[model samples]
Target: MSAPGPSESGSTTRRGAAFADIRRRQQATRGRGRRTRSLFGMMRPYRGRIAILLVALLVATAASLAPAPLAAKAVDDGLSKGNLDHLTVLVAVLLGVSLVGLVATVVRDRLVGWLGARLLSDLRERIFRHLLQMPVSYHERQRAGVLVSRMTNDVDALQTMISSSLVTLISSVLMLLGSIVILISLDLKLALITFTTIPVLLLGSLAFRLASVDAFARTRETIGAITAHLQETLSGVRVIRSYGREQGHLDRFHELGDENRRANMKTVYLNAAYFPAVEYLSTAAIVIVLLVGGAEAIDGAVTIGVLIGFVTALDNFFGPITELSNVYTTFQSGMAALEKIGALLDQESTLTDPAHPRELPDPLRGELRFEHVTFGYGVPSRGGSASAGGTGASSSPIVLHDIDLTIPAGATVALVGSTGAGKSTLVKLAARFIDPSEGRVLLDGVDLRDLRQRELRSRMGIVPQEGFLFSGTVAENIAFGRDGATREDVERVVASLGAGDVLDQLPQGLDTEVGERGGSLSAGQRQLVAFARALIAGAPANGDGRLGGPSILLLDEATANVDLRTERRIEEALELLLSDRTAIVIAHRLSTIRSADLIAVVEHGRICEAGTHEELLVRGGAYAKLHEDWQRGTTDAPSAAAS
Candidate 1:
């Protein structure tokens, strides 16, 4: 049989694509429904308060309904009969109704406000906790700003819905229901006449909902993009300015802003046309009521008092329709936000602790091992061309593969390798930040996966090349390493590490502000602070005599960013810190790690050579060649500083 022509295949492909799109949309709809249900389920715990809130809303709405009827009585009974006392009574009754409404409104607002605040706090905490629980690979694949927007913009939208717009929507609904019942009871004909305009309002609302659903979602996405771009730009502003690309970044920002403005303007355009159209329709309905009621009164079918009452009741009916339209934008924005937040909450941490985790041995030996470990970030490690992270199209690019290595207790093992040689990946595996796809990483002769992550990590101290610090004083940053670490503890930790230069150089000594991420401190200063922090980890458990820190110290090119002078000081600090601790150091300078007990030379995700520094030099293999090059001032290891 002959193969089908291109046009025929194209048509078939298009049909399949269309079907897939429809299925995806259906799945999304179901997911949104589930998320909405879950959201409501979360609120079930506050059901009692919600019940009270509903009662208050209903009472306020009922009180608002009383004014129109009272006015009618004042006109028909008091004025028509010229009874001054009756009019005064009606006026007083109206004032009392107003007071009731005011009180109900206060109660409803307070409850809604409290609920919104509590829920927002809970949701933000949940998102942050979830993000923290996620694997390192998950973070590697996501933009920081996008994750930040989940807690900020998304939660804010839902907060507004709960605090204000939702209350308005509910109260308006009650108003509509109450107004229609009163109108029908007083004069069925006029009620039916007003009800005739209902279909028109419904049709308009339906159109608006359909047109604005995607628009509101797009606005949420555009704002997220804006946030991501702003964050990225700020983070790399130094590079941009150095490259004289300030105008380029500004132009990019303007592009993002334009996209956000365009998305928002879509809703603005819809509201401009839709809400005003609603107002116009309600006005037309009121005019119709007045015209018909006036004629009925003139013909003596209805009294002027009834006519006035009907007109006043018409405001209650139409006003709600107008109010609902006003809040539609907020409702739509909130629902769109809910969809994004729900998706984030649905993301489960890929690495879960064992159901019954093994506890680390007291005074952990900190012996580390990687057995046949194979891993890749968000890609198949076995083999198949991955688009990202570099590889031949027909081959898989694994970050670490079939690796076996061991560090005996209290031994310093330095990892010497070129860029992308799986040096950092090994450290992450040891830390259980990301699990290996194929083999096992063990600490204290037990599989790392069998132990609780916090328990496993509590005994290991990791210091990256660039020391990251929080926005706080140096003492607080140091105290972050240990719970309840007082100023004395900080001083002791610092003194133990022999990093007096770190504090002595600071303007406020230990109390010096590090600024955001220690930006105010020099690179060397940050590293010193980081080392002190690492040394304080297990101090409390040891009665504060020895540093009693993590038994394992993982230093990933920790000295690569500093100058020779700082490196010497850091080396001096490490000499003291490394005593009786299993040290895994990823070093760029061969001279620094000369005393390392074991040196492993890694190349292209595999360990090509392992031995003492002098032994590797004697072998004259990959490590020897790297050492020769390094001695000649050609250090390739620190160029990129690991993957």
Candidate 2:
């Protein structure tokens, strides 16, 4: 077997020989405890349907066994005696048995198909819900493409195995077992001859399964990696084109694809070598039966009818043996996929609500506070692995240290700092995207950890730095934050934010389609739409036609990506979204910081300066130095109209 990569390996492992031995034991124990049990647990919900399907399979097997014996009876009781009426009656009996078997086969297939579809639907829903509830830090550390592959490609492989191999294995085993018993009953000596070659087929099947387990596992891993690479490439296509790296990406993709091809080919070659060996053994068994049974029949030791029946029974037995080997390949692949999926399910979300969650008081005041907050990306101890729920180095380095800040009701607080200065991280904490490693974040005098996440988040509005939009109409995207929002509500928010000009530029206004991730809209248009979405979300109602969203707004670089003209439009929209709410803005542009009610200059996870923009400028602190740089840049560029 190929060695495990950094990612397929466990979260913790040891390197030295003694430690490696311990690690292996731990992994084996874990596998024995949960892997197989989880796989069977997935099937438990469909046990009733599976039971009915098995009954159909057994009936089909009994019908199939009847035809061989009836043929024997026809030759012995009618053909040999020259009784024309008996022959006709025996032939008619065979036809009835065949028809019954055909119907049973159809019923079995329908049951299998239905069960497979239901299991797949349930599995997909379970995985998606689990992933959605995982801490945001888990997603931040994972590749988008890898996660998508787990949801799509891995699940598809599992579905194929469940729908085909599982049914085939059960039916084939029943047919093989029933045929062997009938063969022994028909002619003892001929059955003994058939049993001699059965050992060879069983041994070959075992060998084939062992070899295929590793081959299919490798194939699954390679496909997941290739999918992840492709997803990353597609998402960054603009960067590749701008940097003239198209050929480089194509070459890398081809390399990964070639690896996948080789892995699959290995499985193909194993099957090629295995199935023919089974066919050879099966044919050899028939030849032995012919040689032994023919002599015995001619010597008056066995009847011709019994000889013919034994040969037919042998064929039925070995055919299933060969088919069973083929099913083994799929079984191995399904097990491999289950292992990966189980690992994902085993991951525990680091953040969860208290057992008895406390609710905020009726009518929240939109106040937020950070009490001695300190956060980092990793574990505190030496050699301890950090949770996948976090990103960056394994060794924890403090990002925010002893931060105690509070924003009163309906205040705007802007965070300003250089890149990597923890501005974004602080904003994320306010939204409880990631909790502080040390200290507590409270909303309206209550700890955030004590409140249910959905309840807390639903009462606040958050606009991310990227301004991502789903594939939908302009109106749909705007109303996404507030379920059941009316057309009038969307229009009022649009006009209130001065985003009507953006609608005029669109092809169909509110009905215009935004491509995937809002690709069809300009960066500025997406920002304005996101702003309007935030504004309309959680709006308070006065029983009239007016509804306003949550009283708190979190803006993370709201104007980071837009051009100057687009930035002005977003700034105008932002003014309305931020009005009458507690606003925390992560600033990238100088204009945003300049207009803040309070500005806190962040440096290496600590607030080095805090005051009004002018107060900091007059103090000549870190904020003053940053303002000086901004003024110098403005002097070097042409002035534009303000929002």
Candidate 3:
């Protein structure tokens, strides 16, 4: 296969960079809608719990208000009247009310915590479910690290608001309202004087909210940026070290961290300015009330008890105002989080299940067909390769255009091409990982688009060029191929593939940890394990003839990343697995090239040659040229390896 020119590689890099920038801007600049609606929408499912919580808050508020009035009664009706019995009774009532308020507070908090936890759980699950339904194209266009940040940091901010900040907000509003009502009843003149500062408080709050909203939005963006940078850098740490680019990566990380710091500083500055101003206004209100109420008490216009009660109400009022300043900050942060998370939830996936899907046949014949298929990334412009991670760099708009091909049931067909010939895209079509933009892929005479994805995919087995494994034991990774697969089933598949020898070499055999992405294993070992996983997922049934495994196999250069010995083992395993199944294999090696039952040579989004190996050789066309090149490379490999 010829290598891409400098222009093609440069274009790919530029396109990838441009695409990433566009995505980040979209995430950052999404419309800022009212968070209350989104928050309530999530809480709607727990309406019963919310109603109960509100009732508890109301009870608590009422109980808290009881003490101020009782103090007044103790002063005016008991102490002033020299009635010891009344004073004692009033004190007892105040104590009882306080205790009831405490109990109610505890109950309210518990309910709030429960509701918050449940909402977070539901939100996380909903995001994950939606993501699962999204098409491969959507994920390809996104950065996994950014998505992780959305799922973690962004969601966590909202969770914090729910679990802790919400209680403060509710308590402040309730206290503020209760304080105002009681102050009016105690002494209307004094209450009106105290309420004079209300406008200042309102204005300050509004200003803070407006200023802090954008600050917190930037904070969220910086957080995502830093997280994405860290994840990307660490995932490629080995590459950085090998290339001696650690300092360059460190500088980049420092830049991201610095941006995060600056964003946080903006919120800090806003809080510093807003909170102190609120406190000053609150204190000013208190002093004026103290001065005016003292004059009224001295002149005998108001009772000492009434003045004292009014002063207490004044404290309650200003206290909540100060508390609400803090709550406003938290709310702004939560709102920022909601905007980011809401954007993610609003993303529409291109791939969707048909309203009414046709059921596939019970015993699938596994025949595969592509009819006049065409596809592009998103725009008309196209350049993508069939190779893993290759975006075919084409000056034209089409990637795969009007290509036609078929693989008969129980036949082994190999696709051979240059790096960007759309072989992998063809394989993806067979797996229905993506839909063709202009044509149809059929399985057993039924259009793939008409079949349910889950049922259709369940009957097919695919192993991509890259073998990805999760963090788990070797046995667990293998068993992941099929749900509910047992240790015995794993062992049986291993034994059949003669993979027991590989397992025996591990320190803990089947229990050996694969680490993240099977990092604990060599490339060859990982491939072997992946192959075993595929085998077990599609293992043949018992003697009763009931189908247990997949009927179709799609292998995209399964041996591309392994050593010669490993490749031989994989080929041997493939021989047994492919004997009774329809198979489509993407070939890069000469050995794979010669062994295929039918070799299809793809060129520029079309099949330029198709025939048996011997027949193609006799024709002396593209296949013949590819065959000669393979032979020449095989001859030179030994010398190249020795040097």
Candidate 4:
């Protein structure tokens, strides 16, 4: 056929480019067989049901094939011979076969559909479980929309293969084999003539299969891209509207939509060409059969009944051939999806719990020590080699260098720093989010790494800068860490934290629903809720003394965003919470850190000065300068109390 018209030609060009990109990605995917095998292995648990479905398919194909031969016999013996009894018998048999085929098909389809849905559910659950186990870094790099698509679109593709393609492929093969054997038995010469077009049919199918792989891959990828774009745009819709970028975003969306449209059209074109080409080849086979059989019949080499049987079988053969070609496409799409999913499953976590981790001693005391700690955050070496820099040195040259510091149990240490001063990094080391590159973080004189991570973290309460909450009621958000807490338990924690007024202010009090990420609540409210959650979690679960209160409290910009009144209430609450806990508070506002027992002024990832709030003012150093700046910003005259 001639190439599509000019408008169509332009579309084809765009589609071709899209397909090329998809092909490049497919080529880059490693371990095709491993992925395919793993996907198949998932179905092994349901093998018995699959086998029953296959048996039903075979029976359906056989019953379907039976009617064709019976009709051919009726054509020659009843119509040509004018025999009524033979015609009636053959008609009845054909009707019975059709009924049997219908029943078998329905049973097979229902069974396979159930199997596919069950397998898909299992696969989704498995993936979700793995996702939960994955570290925070994995989520940091992945797009929400793309991950959602993998669970939905990719799994649905495999579902189609299992529900339809699996049975269809088996039945088609059986039907084709039955037709070929019967046709040759009826007339070898005509069968040979039909066989001549097999090579053409095979070549056309191979070409279509090869081209379709790229086309389908493009279609899948474009869908993911469009999904990701929509997710990102919708999440930031408020910003987009505020900045008057709606029209710009709409234009970009249209561009992505056009790309998706072109990809689908390409797949359509390939499918359109493939089916017609196969039909033409089948028609060619039929024409050859007719020419060779007609001559043989006239020369008295074959009977009319046998010739009719050959022609009838040819019709049956083409149906399976066409179906098989379609199944090939489904197989390829499923295989490609499996490969992507398997790669994700095969990835090993970079950080895992150690084997035989040391147990924590009873009645844990909060004596935190940093012993000659030198660390770098992930930084490139001068020679350009990539290094997993320790938390201390990762962000800049070194947040902490040769730092040896010890905090006595129940001491309040405040970390005061400007931006990029590594105050956050220092606290993260104590939390064990990342280990030190050199030296060690010791908790009660034991190496932090030697203790179980879960055991160590359980004794700590953190009020992060941005208080994150899940989709639930305000009460649930507060009681998140402690299990099986009663309503009274929740109310007590809220009252103690001075957040009871926050509950009363809400429309539904503690029962009010917090929208996703606590979007419904104000920033101050969210922070208070997080503080309540930490306090409740730190409290002993059972009256048994096994689990103690939080031995360490790490606050990073905890009150930075709260109002002055809320900050004061939080400070009052903190006085009670910090009485028996070792507290490390990271703050930018000098006012918040002024009452700290000891304040360390961090600059260039190092502590430039450290002393009590009053003594730091007397030192005439970085802390003194910062204190003077704070006084000037707050008051016209520096009061004696400030010194």
Q: Give a tens-digit lDDT track for model 3, residues 1-643.
A: 9988999999999999999978975655555544457678888888998898888888898887777777777888888799999999888888888888889888998998899889989989988998888777678767888888988998899988888788888878998999999999998888888888888888887887767777898999999988888888888888999999999988988998899999999999989998898888888877888898889889998888887777777778888888888887777788788888888887766555678899888677888888888876553211222221224344435668888888898988999989999899888888877777677799999988788888787777777778899999999998888878888778877776667897779999999999998899988788778877877665455676333567888889888888776677667766776878888989788686566778998888889989889999999999899889987887789843563
Candidate 1 to truth, TM = 0.91
TM-score of each: 0.91, 0.91, 0.89, 0.84
Per-residue C-alpha lDDT of model 1 across residues 305-350, encoded as one tens digit per residue: 7788888988999898888998889988998999999988887666
* Count of residue pairs whose backbone atoms collide, per candidate: 0, 5, 7, 10
Estimate, for each residue in 433-453, the C-alpha lDDT of model 2 and write its tens digit: 777877878899998878998
lDDT agreement with native, every candidate: 0.84, 0.83, 0.81, 0.78
Q: Against the hidden true structure, what lDDT does model 3 obtain?
A: 0.81
Tens-digit lDDT string for candidate 4 (256-296): 89998998788788888888888888887888778878888
Question: Which candidate would rank higher by TM-score, 2 or 3?
Answer: 2
In angstroms, how far off is 398's CA in candidate 1?
1.8
> Could you report the Cα RMSD, in angstroms, for every candidate shown?
4.2, 5.1, 7.6, 7.3
Q: Order the candidates by lDDT, highest first.
A: 1, 2, 3, 4
Per-residue error for 529 in candidate 4, Å, reads: 1.3
**Which stretches of model 3 miss by more than 4 angstroms?**
1-35, 379-396, 544-548, 639-643
Question: Would you list the clashing residue pairs of candidate 2?
Answer: 538-549, 538-550, 539-548, 539-549, 540-548
Which is the winner by lDDT between candidate 1 and candidate 3? 1
